[model samples]
Target chain A: MSAAPAPRYLARPLAAIGRPVLAGLASVGRMAIFTLTVISHLIRPPFYPREFAHAIMTIGWYSLPVVGLTALFTGGALALQIYDGSSRFSAEAAVPSIVAIGMARELGPVLGGLMVAARVASSIAAEIGTMKVTEQIDALVTLSTNPIKYLAVPRVLAATLTVPVLVAVGDSIGIMGGWLVGVNRLDFNSAAYLKNTIDFLEAADVASGIAKGAVFGFIIAMMGCFYGMSSGRGAQGVGKATKLAVVASSVLILGSNYLLTEVFFSG
Target chain B: MIELQDVHKAFGDKRVLCGVTLTVPKGESMVIIGGSGTGKSVTLKCILGLVTPDAGTITVGGQPVTKGDRDAFLARFGMLFQGAALFDSLTVWQNVAFRLLRGAQKRARAEAREIAIEKLRRVGLKAETADLYPAELSGGMQKRVGLARAIAADPEIIFFDEPTTGLDPIMAGVINDLIREIVVEMGATAITITHDMTSVRAIADDVAMLHDGVIQWTGTVAEMDGCGDPYVEQFINGRADGPIEAVR
Candidate 1:
């Protein structure tokens, strides 16, 4: 009897797990269809140029200060860490080249992209998710305005354009931070550190990082729009969607950072 | 001006609306009354194309409401949702002038704000209220702002979905009276869905009782007292026992 009950309990748990797995698959299928529908709507007419312009200003220009501050500080800290670590092996001479390459190829774009994903993704999801909960999305449809074009396209475009620029600026500042640390902290000459950084960093490293930034930007905005549009009814639903957007964007950024680095750096 | 013919809607295994049919003539105020979950709100949503009926036809101003053309069809109608449904990010003036600032009716910001403030005043709100957000307003004031927005474009048809649901008796009466005045002034066809008898008596020219997703009886306010239908009687009198089941 005891053995029978144990097996029955195990069966129930197995069934419970199976149900959610199926449900999750179904949800993914529904989301795919919704995404396709949104894309189709995006290419159609009745475009709202004014709304697009406003979104670009809000998502891109307004977000610059936060992204800039994050990138600058991260670069400065990275330089300090690299200098300390390299001095252990009596390889202090390699500090300038390693810092320059590391910042341009990985740290600069990844940190900048992650910071933006936090700021931009959360804001987009929260704003649009609230609109969805309140039936304003329905109201927009009733008013003959296409919600995808008015809401999604502008955000996606702004992130795509702005993140690359953010990455580029971040790369320059990060290299400058490394240069400062190599000279001031590691007792390296300022002129030699600057020359070494300039010599070691190649155009491909910068280009690849910026390219990753653009892709990261697209992923961040897409996740935000997707979650916001699919938010369920009421305040709790909006809050959940906002949290999911931030988490999803952050995960995708880190994962993509690895993949992009592999692609760019593999021998 | 709005007519539904044998409308039917079901969610999964549960049937909410089962062949509901009703009509509201032009320049008239019709109030639909029903207990909760009997499809009173669903009927209004069907008419507005907010909810698509599984089977049946809904027409407005003699034109059929096709699925994709809901926007153009809805443009002629104004709606006050159950909870006001104001945009939280927008100021009171912006919410009121939303439609006016879109499409062909687009106005300059200053002009839109001026019109919005005027409408706010018409709803008995102060000019300073226009700069505030909907969150800052009282429930009654939010409903008033919703009313202002609904009538802002002077739509030929207006829908009030439980306009008095969350208000006190006095506030509900005020809203009912305001609705009556606005409908009369605009000469527009208005459909209001409510369970509030006070709202029914105050605003309805004709009253329709929806029981079990069908119109049990429809008549003028004078005729409602003499309706004689047991279901209608049970509802209007708020009796505990009647022919209608208390449980599903």
Candidate 2:
């Protein structure tokens, strides 16, 4: 009897733990299928040029102010921190190159992507989630429109194309921001600071950041569309989807940044 | 014609539709009446292929719903959702002309706008209302825009899910009249899901009562009162005491 009870107790706890693990795995599978569907739709569409144009405006142009501001402040702060840290060893001259390389290789793309994720991911999820809740997506279906083609493909394509450009612009502004702070506050010569930054930033560094930006952009839009399209029901359901979109895209951005860095520079 | 034979659907452990079988003849206005959560919406969704059934066969015009070019099949139908479900980003006319402006039914910009405006007028909206976004309109106006959109494509089959829901009695009456007039005028088969008796009386030539996952009764509206089905009587009378558990 004691042995039988022990099996029962063990079974109950195991099932409880297994349930969530299974659920998480199922969600991952669903997201994989969703990603494949989006990619397939991208190539097979009676493409919506209008929707693509609108998405480009919404995801790229509208995100600029926030991306710019985040990069500016971050670059300035990085310069200050680098200057203070290196002065201890009389290595103050290393600040400009380090800041340039850091911004071009890491901070610019990551922060820019994060800012866009906070802005675009939440909005995309909310809009599409509300559409799902309201049955507009079904309405599209009834009207002989494929929701994935009409909605997800345009947004995903626009994001993939535009985010790299945003990263490039962000890298330039960031380097300028570091220069501004270094010359004004740290008493570095403006021309010397600019020369050092230019010398330190290799084409590969900038290219790698831009490449990461494209992947991060895809993650942001994919998470938003996937959550939105699969959202449960009602206001609470849409809210949950929006929250998940932001959280998932942000996490994926950071996680992929690590992997991409390994691929691009681990040699 | 639309037919569902032994349809079954369950979400998780909650069985929503169980062995529901019904038939809707062509050019007939069939209104499905049921209590809240009785699978009325799910039934419509199943017919539209928006929600797949766990087990069943559904056919339209003797063609299986699942077989054929999905786009061509969907082009035959239009649906008005309970919440209007107008695209928030588009203007009222743009919403109405959505189908016409794209795909196989593509029309010139001016031509599509003209058709959208004409449909808007038919639904009792002014031409000026066409340019305004859905959010800029009142609930009643939004519903009219939705109605206009439903008929814009002139689909052979149309479905209205709670067409008169959330409107004032006067507005409800107006919408019912509009729906009836539109169905008759277009010679389109219609399936409406509603619990509103007034709408059933106005819009249905025949009525089907859904209860306990299956259609409990179905007959002409004229025969509905004398149908003698306990579920139909309980539902028609809106009574709490009956075979159906009111709490559910």
Candidate 3:
């Protein structure tokens, strides 16, 4: 083939590389437009209160048990690990303070968000994706209802408002978990451990974690809806959207968690 | 009255509608026929504003279809989707009264339910059927519920998309007859997109054949038989060897 000519050969590889990059950029642009549409509809008239209430009950109330379980186990494990590590330098007494700070500042919001993403995001994506495939979304439009307002905004608003509350509950339950482990397993003085946890955790520490939760909740519900509206083809398309909803929401929660931490404590 | 002038649309590289133009005068039922994927449904969607046209204007009642008061605009029109797109989450009555439950068409909950029951009765559904979800109904029952919802608000304009695509011949004939009676009784402007000649003869005052993204023929149903347009002739006769491919 005469080596395929040097310039043409280089052009083929370059075009191949540019193709995926272009597609990715286009995907991002589409998502940005969808996000803006959702936000605009959020403030407009004809808001659906029934739908919003239903979403709050689904995303917030139904999600509490799993969140509680995850917080409890994580808190206990965290206390044990902190006690073991801090003992090397005769610093075992620091377990209560560290566990309180850790649960309140990071683990509470991040883990609760990821758990909700795993549970709720996938469900929202699957439900909406199936609706798209079955043409119910189109039916809603033809019936003089805006799908963004009826479907997306309600779920997103519910998540944003409820997740911070969930994070607060998770934080309390988590601290209790640490207290139980510290008193029963770690042999720490009971009153002293409680006093240290309470003293080390400032108002800002709890506020910062709950605030992170609100951001994570927004990302979780938005990704579910974003992928759902953008779903394609058929059963396989819905399946892919469900998977991406969970994966994207989890990654976004962790990434935004780090960014929010930097902002809240960088000083 | 409704009119489309030089409407154009495309999905990526596939140009689904290229310069489609047509008009339906007040109280007339216009049927658009074309082979699969030749943009028949896209034409209906363009009029409904579900799919935006890349070019040209659509007007309803001598006003541009895209402008002001969308709720008021859509409230004047009703559409029966090809797949009977009822909300599975709701019972039959809820789906029928969906429009009445909110917006400018809002009604008291009890009144809306009563109207839903009345519409269901008109479509031959029993009041007891109103409490059943769409999934619990047979396909024909579901289609009737969809039809009930379409006419629940007593729209000034009604569009039926593939009204008999997936029904047995007897059920299809029943649906076609009901559609004919309903359209005549209401005197509503109707546009139906379907390739079924039986439905055409049963529903159309005027017929338009779409081919290759444009109107291939336009005339009354009486003229469709003698217009000598090969595309219309081939399509109506279901010929495999002529213009519309047996396999596009």
- Interface RMSD value for candidate 1, one decimal? 2.0
lDDT, candidate 2, A152-182, per-residue tens: 9999999998888888888888877888899
The candidate that wins on lDDT is 2
Better TM-score candidate (2, 3): 2
| Candidate 3, CAPRI quality class derived from DockQ | medium
TM-scores, one per candidate: 0.89, 0.97, 0.94
The better candidate by TM-score, 1 or 2, is 2
Q: Order of candidates by DockQ, top first?
A: 2, 3, 1
Model 3 C-alpha lDDT per residue in residues A1-267, reported as the tens digit of each score:
556556887889999999999998998898889889888988898898998999999999999998999899989999999999999999988898889899999999999999999998999999899899888998898888999899999999999999999999999899889889999998888999999998888999999999999999899899999999888869999999999999989988999998999999998
lDDT at B81, model 1: 80
lDDT string for model 1 (A1-267, tens) is 345455777889889999999997996786577567656766677676766677678767776777767666766687778768877887777778887788778887888888888888888888889888777786666555667877887777678877888888888877777666666776789998888888888999889989998989887887888889888778888889889888888998999889988888888
lDDT value for candidate 2?
0.93
- Best candidate according to TM-score: 2
Q: Please identify model 2 stretches exceeding 4 Å from their true place.
A: A1-6
Computed on alpha carbons, the lDDT of every model, listed in order, comes to: 0.83, 0.93, 0.92
Evaluation by lDDT, superior candidate among 2 and 3: 2
Model 3 chain A: worst 10 consecutive residues (lDDT sum): A1-10
